[model samples]
Target: MISVAAIDARIWQAIVAGAFVAIGWIVNGWQNRRVAAALRAERTRDVHRALYAEIASCLANLDSPEALAAYRDAMAARMRDDPGFVPLIPRERNDTVFRALVAEIHILPRVTIDPVVSYYSQLFAIEAMIADMRGERFRALEPERRIAMYEDYIALKVQAFHDGHFALRMIDAYATDGRNGAMEEEARITREISAGFDTAGAAARAASRISSPGAVRSGRSPE
Candidate 1:
């Protein structure tokens, strides 16, 4: 038979060994959790960067005030004879990154997701209008109706520019951890771009007004 003292010593040793194993397991789990969190944060930031770059590129393609002016001029020049004329639209774009990672967009800050979705939605609308313009339905319309459609297309494009800027502002703020007075800088950019749009519109209207007198003098209706 074992002595009581010997049995008590064996039990104490078992308890100590089991306590060490449990402590080791808890520490290992904690370390794993910490590493996983770090990786997750890094991945989120990477997603933000990719999205920011892609959206910035798209916005750059559409943000040209000069391009907008050129389109207006080209349309005005062609409207009398080429009623079917279409203004220059950006090449159809694919939101590859956004499509691939849409499932994970939720990882973005809650406030950001809405603007991101909104911008993309505007882009899709623009693309759809571009597609429709290429179809026979657009060509079949009267000249006046076709002009109305073009006006609608320009309105949509302008709205997309505003939306793209807004999305970029939100993403930039998130990427910078909401520091560095980014909002003020973004606001200035927004204002400038908006002013560019306004200036282009004003110039186009002035040109139309100037041309109207010539049409009146020539006994022809202004286009």
Candidate 2:
């Protein structure tokens, strides 16, 4: 013969306890989600920072006046010396950061990912061409063909330089949180520089020179 009022009080107590448990669970879940989001944002920023440094270094090496002059001299030497002479093409062998974080690159902004990937892909292409130039088939090619191949390699490097610029622009935009005019000036400068570099015309000139009556003859095949 328990009183009804006592039973009702117990029921209210249980309800209150259940309500508190639900609120605690909700708060804990919300906290965890907030922390995860923050971590993701931080990781994205870290990727951007590392990639920016690497790309900037590459741009510095490739787009510098000294580098351009060195490349021009090398090509001229190759054209003047034995046609079989392989010009030393400067390229980066270090891609550790990109290789390590490529899988997680998807975590970056959608717009940034493509340009970044494109830049690296161009680098890969350059590497492949370098490898081919060192192979036996390249040595077997005619003098004009060899010049054309070398010209193509230069064109690839130039393309990679442009692609690197695009990647940096995208990264800058993301790092600035999509701020208006964040990379506008840089983009305009890039466009102007790109306009000045005519890869196709240069390649055409090289090919035309080698095709003329008097061209450097191929030397002994590389050992």
Candidate 3:
């Protein structure tokens, strides 16, 4: 039979061992969580960085009508290849948020005061019209009506492209006329708007909200 003292000592040893094991498990779990969170943040940051770069490239190419049209076509192709690129899906709240943000930024008079603003405004109007037509309520419309709406959308897109080209030509003319300061001002405003949209904190928050597990089920994410 074991002595009482020995029994008590063994029990204490067991308790201490268990406590250490528990602490180790907790520390391991915490470390794993930290690593996973960091990886997720890195991935999200990369995605948003790519998106901002694409937007900046598009804006820069607006100076060339051919490039603008090419960009638009590339965007349309991407939308076709990746349904996620289309903002029509209700579950894709980020898409809608991005579109709304772009529209709001475009409409701001600070940047829109330039002649190019008219062209962008028209482009945004077409985008809004397309969004409306894709809404759930519009699904019940007759086939013919849907066709007409689509035709109108195409027409608007083409007209906006032409207008954008014309605006680019005007910008070129201004450059030739030595109104370089005005062009510089426009470029500065564009950079400011891009910076505002691409701020790391804001993009991180937006990505976090969109990628949250709860957002997947809700079809919407918190602002």
Candidate 4:
């Protein structure tokens, strides 16, 4: 038979070994969670960079009075020929990646997120306006009135131009410098657009440039 003292010592040793195993398991779980979280964050950042770069490219493509001119020319010709034409708005952003990472967008820093979301939100509005213009009711309006309606869309184009510039700068900052730099760049771009840029005048110039042979399609970069 085993002595009681000897039996108690064996039991205590077993208990100590089991406690060590449990502790190790817990530590491993914690380490795995931390690493997973880090990986998710890195992936989110990468997605944001790709999306941002696309938006920056779109901004570069559309920020010119020439691009807006092309659209106006196309619309004027469409009004004359197609008669049921829906004027094209200049919003060439790619949102497929953005939709794919919807969950990660919520986790991103708000300073950067705000600009991106704002830019896309305006695009959504432009899309809605486009649909409305294409509807039967808008097309039924007199040709002169139709032209006037499309001219009123100058507001949307001008606002979008500024929004694109601001958002792209914010995205570039995050990709290049950092978030703090992104916020600063955003603020500066907003001020610059607000002060020196004549939104109405630019739209007017673009519209004026649209002349005879207004067959230029939207989406082509200006020369």
Candidate 5:
């Protein structure tokens, strides 16, 4: 039979060993979590960087009407090849940046104008139309068929624009009849539309320049 002292010593030794194991496990787990978090952060940063690069490319290439036309054609072709490539909308770099800006703006207790929402909504609709045109279903059609569809699409766009204009006018009339708040809202939306147009024009000019042969050559040079 073991002595009481020996038994107690053995029990203590086992407890010590178990404690070491637990501590090691905890350290390893913490290290793993840190590593995983760092990796996730790195991935997010990389994605944002890539989006920025693409946006810059779009802006640079906007100058060349021929290039822009070619880009549209290529995009259409891509859509024909892969239907799943279609995004719900075309997202501009400024759009994402502006959203972040608008979020910050909204933190103010009182924003007299709600430009952000109206601008983003209109931008989203335009993007959606572009995405739809680039889809495989549209691209797969014959040239004649595609042209026909495009006409219809343009017509629908025109109709929608008219409807939106009418709605705004009606709202303005109602506002004039009663509350000043409605007029304020209309003014905000108008401001957003103007800003969007200006930004788009800038983006288009950048895009055109990027399509130049010299620009293409420079872009291909080793950084």
Candidate 6:
């Protein structure tokens, strides 16, 4: 027995309530999406920052001529002291970071991408050299053969490390801003990056000197 006017008023109230609820839901969802997008951006930045630093540090370690010489000498000593034992030099590469960046590469700057790609490509070449040197046949070959061929591998590693430093510098250049202390900090970092490249270059030059023709021939030597 409700009046027609009362029925219409109730219907209008229901409709108004539903409309408000819908609007509130949309607003909340939109805000959540914005927050999530921001968090993702921050995470991506963090990943890149960590990746650049790690690659630089790893290259520095690998391109250390003193460390390489020490490792070589240690290996020789171990062979003499324990003929049955073998030691492996630990290899470091930013593979995880690389994959992560590749997954989100669409968001990265094009200039940044090129240097990063070059750095990784160089690393890949160095890795391939290492893999070839560590193959079963390689170990079975004459020790002299190994020594002769290792020069080129060392050269590749050094050059790859040098490229990694270059890539880091490129990234630094792009990220720098003319803010308080930013220029000074960037200059300092650039100097450090340059020093890394110098170390790698020196290592490459030394290895190149030892990359005699005999080494090339040894690559095709019969077991």
Report the number of the highest-TM-score candidate: 2
Model 6, position 205, has a per-residue lDDT of 36
The number of the candidate with the highest lDDT is 2
Q: Candidate 5 on 1-22: residue-level lDDT in tens? A: 9999999999999999999999
Candidate 1 per-residue C-alpha lDDT over 136-198 given as tens digits, one digit per residue, 9 for 90 to 100: 787787877777777788777777666666666655555553423345545655686777744
lDDT tens digits, residue span 144-219, model 4: 6787777666556656666655555555555455556666766776686679864333323332332212111111
- Shift in Å, residue 67, candidate 6: 5.0
RMSD (Cα, Å) for all candidates, in order, is 14.8, 14.1, 17.7, 10.6, 17.3, 14.1
Q: Clashes per prediction?
A: 0, 0, 0, 0, 13, 0
Candidate 1's C-alpha runs over 4 A off are: 64-77, 80-90, 178-223
Worst 10 residues of 4 by lDDT: 214-223
Task: By TM-score, rank the candidates, best first.
Answer: 2, 1, 4, 6, 5, 3
Over 4 Å off, model 4: 1-8, 65-94, 100-104, 142-144, 176-223
lDDT of 4: 0.60
User: Which wins on lDDT, candidate 2 or candidate 4?
Assistant: 2
Candidate 3 — which residues are off by over 4 angstroms? 63-125, 128-223
TM-score for all models, in order of appearance: 0.70, 0.73, 0.34, 0.62, 0.35, 0.51
- In candidate 3, how many Å is residue 31 off? 0.7
Worst 10 residues of 6 by lDDT: 214-223
Per-residue C-alpha lDDT of model 6 across residues 1-223, encoded as one tens digit per residue: 9999999999999999999999999999999987777665555455446556556555645756556667566666655566444335345455666775677655545545566788788778777767776678767756655654565666666566666655555444444421223335446656877776443454333333322222121111010
Cα misplacement distance, residue 193 of candidate 4 (Å): 7.1
What would the per-residue lDDT of candidate 3 be over residues 71-104, giving only the tens digit for each residue?
A: 5555556555654333342211213323534533
Between candidates 3 and 5, the lDDT winner: 3
Q: Give me the displacement of residue 21 in model 4, in angstroms.
A: 1.8
